[model samples]
Target: MPCRGAAACSALAPTLPSARTVAAGGQPMQLPADPIEAARTWARHDPDPETRAELEALIARGAREELAERMAGTLRFGTAGLRGVVGAGSNRMNRAVVIRASCGLADWLIERGLAQRGPLVIGRDARLSSEALCRDAIAVFAAKGLEVRHVPEPCPTPAVAFAARACGAVAAVVVTASHNPPEYNGYKVYGPDHVQIVPPVDAEIAARIAAAPFADEVPRVDDPLAHPRVRPLEGLRERYLAALDGCLAPRPERPGLRVVYTAMHGVGAAYALAALERAGLGAIEPVREQIEPDGRFPTVRFPNPEEPEALALAHALAERTGADLVIANDPDADRLAVSVPGRTGGFEPLTGNQIGALLGDHLLEHASCDRPFVVRSIVSSPLLDRVAAAHGARSVATLTGFKWIWHAALELEGRGEGTFVFGYEEAIGFSVWSQVRDKDGISAAAVLAQLAERERRAGGSLRARLERLYRAHGVWVSVQHSVWRPGLEGRREIEQAMAQLAERRPETLGGAAVERVIDYREGAQARPSYLGRAELVELQLGESGRALVRPSGTEPKLKIYVDLCAPADGEIARIEREQRERARAVALELARFVGLEG
Candidate 1:
């Protein structure tokens, strides 16, 4: 089953024990060994009534399968930290899990002699159970005899990371689920460097968590916020806002453009509006319906800006206002989504790649420092590479996620390789400045607003600028396809698929010859620190096209990323259409090769 470990299996529910039941391919369903006993033990010690009752109900109903699933081992901590549904059981993210994670982190720091270094910073987002989780963590850290600082209020993820670095804290914890569904929440940890924890640190903390005392056994203090070691995060918001302001340029004149922005019911609107206005891009109209921080995210099915449906409200608002541009940020505001008015009236949201290219080009063009460089995920559009090169800058590719991108950027700066200017991932994450060594949607939105204003003043549009970029560079188009692979069996299927692909690497994809294959599983390439031991495969194709396959780190899905370049000289529209078709074709082939159904 691509065995992560016995503990993970214990936290994960296995197949049904029914005599007639079989696996996906008519194979015998192998049940987890004594998972019910483990589940009972976990339930007995669970501190949360909701989750405890959940386990009790499953036990009362004699739901062996459900109980086993709940008892299956604890969720493993990785680069993204702890993320799961909020419910009972060790596999879930609950008060007990949060307590253990926090205590374990405390133990790790203390063991490293970092407990006396500085206060640890903690922040929460507007999500159900987020505050509770944050409180649980604070109590644990306080009880561990370490100082702690809490954000003055619920803020974006980047703010917490920024606070960790700005405050010189030994570490930080952010209670959020990022763009996950409302039913899900997560715990993200950052090291002293303010970047997400990676490698031995994550492993050490995970081991400590696994070995921690039961929830009730862990000492808890009441009103940890009032404790002397607990300090208020005064002026953190202002500091973050000021950092974002640094990304701005003196606008010759306010473009007086109509812009509609939506926070997707996130904690970003307040910060986003302030940053945009401070950048002198003129005031922007807010999508009032989705303005506030509503953890329920009632307006959209998904809180991610990359989803077209998530931006539906913003698009409608933009059209009604005849807005010149549209901007939307995901729940935590670590990612941004921008849209320009389409020819047909509705606003057309720009793909993360397009936005990355535009932002990279603009920032590189205006860069005043020498040895300027931009960073992008290996799977992201290579168009940024061309853009950076054209502007006499270098483009560095890192493994996916801001943890890797930011670390790479800092390493380059430390080594005097170049000055870190911009960094982005295809999944709507961007880091416009180094102030917050992570994705800062607030600043990214501000930068884009400036771009739109400049383009408008030049008698052009962002889309026109994009077309010019295309005409200058080749038409770099890309598409992503996903196959839902849930549970342990699903994980096994993904592993088998990747192994099969490695065994028989495709000779061609979408009529393009496969030139080479890069298997990240083997660590064949120099990767970011946080991407240690991740299973991924990439195929380098002719014409600057690439096909990458990997299981989503945070979601139960197999993702296939495809990128292709086509001639952009003739009809830009025609080239775009043709290249998009080619990208889709390549994605389809990769999906098929990975045994995913269309």
Candidate 2:
């Protein structure tokens, strides 16, 4: 039967055909029996005219294969929430998908009896489709009889996170893709604890989303913001700034720190600048071309600050302005990147581990807590543990992801193990303050600025401070190697590689002996309960170094992290260079051992 309209299609459940079909060369294939029918149903119910037309065009062109791919499966909701290219299908990030996701989230909240606890906060970035999708989410929440609060403009993600915590909301959702490419958009859900939803909860939400009603069938309020259940999330930015004020300890202002900052065409300019000024950090030179919240990201090939090309303009500005420090925030402004003027003149970007070590040392040095503790992800450099121990503080390592990092910190603090001072991941994500459980690049930038200024006031530079710390704790050099394998075959290859490594552990890597192997999948009684199970393998090389192999949670790639250390008995630069080479060699060996040498 042909679907006539939106109401008619709501009753249709487009399920994958169970029967297999023959393909070219008599190969077996499992594809939808009638993808056109599925497309027609989806098109009828798609609220957005753009997406509806998109599906219609595909159907008109008899693009059966393409349609099947688009309808292969719904987007998977993991710990990171939903992220994908914006388009017109169940597998894409679109209005219909957002509506269904919102409805499911509403169902989960109601089932958990959290819907009436507080308002559900919604926020979005400057992505092209973010505003519309955010509205769709708001409408669904309002229609579900839940109180909705939303940020009025494009703002840093940390601002939304802080708003969720300060407002005592039951849950929050941010419509953003963070540092993902321009074509991507995402939905990030935060539990009442002000952190990303973790396991059991993530699984629960996924089940609800899978059982959600069709987009058109879900009740939605037109002009949701005007509804009595919805209200503007006011004073969010101001409150965020006020929280930043608490991140800094009282210290003399160093009015001479010249810094060049870039938002990478993100929404961080206003918030970062306000935080800097509030801290009495001298005027920061903003990259004019990339300061605004332009989703197109017209200035860079990639919006991620960790990418060298993304920070090229900032480096240029820093050189031209003779700035002492260069700081950048990824789009959505949840992660931070920094560079400092090298002894050789040009600005040298600091690795995430370097920054983490420096910031960990700085925070511990001035910590007010009698038992300050820091946390780092398993993939992050282990130097933080040394830094923590040097300061007589405890250091905890959790499974990869800021969600795990923050949750571990909270659990430890609750048990009176220590006061949570800071936590960071190897991906440039940092949480300088505990109030906002997730990473806050805006606050981190301010704290980094303070660290830079303090170093300058002491007649030293960040580089010099880093060297001093290295001298105290052996020099640690960390490097990351990634092997990209896209599509189903690639995913299988990644899984095979991990399985092989776990089965046949390498005796040595880069000529260094592998003393022990820790497979995270096999939970350890010695490990904290919150560490959880993850598909990660760690090869400990005694005092020389260590290597970690794991598949990326978000992208289709296998990642290997190598960390090597050397005594700072000689030239620090030479030791760092040599250790870095050793680390890269170890990473390459690990990749080759897993048959992922590409």
Best by lDDT: 2
- Cα RMSD of all models vs. native, in order, equals 9.4, 9.7
- TM-score of candidate 2 versus the correct structure, residues matched by position: 0.92
Model 2 segments beyond 4 Å from truth?
1-40, 60-65, 251-254, 524-526
Model 2, range 1-598, lDDT digits (tens) per residue?
1101111111111121232221111111122447888888878878889999999999999998788767767788654689888898777889988988887788777776777778998899999999999999999899888999899999888888878777778889999999988989999998866778777678877777777766877789989989999999887888788756666756464488888999999999999988887766666899999998999999988899988889989999899988989999999999999999877788888998989999888888877766788899999999999999988988989988888887787677666666778889989999887657788898889888888988888899989988998998899999999999975668789999999987799998888889999998886566786687888999999998899999987777999999988999999999998988888888998999999997
How many clashing residue pairs, candidate 2?
0
lDDT by residue (tens digit), candidate 1, 258-282: 7898988989988888888877765
Q: How high is the CA lDDT of each candidate model?
A: 0.80, 0.83
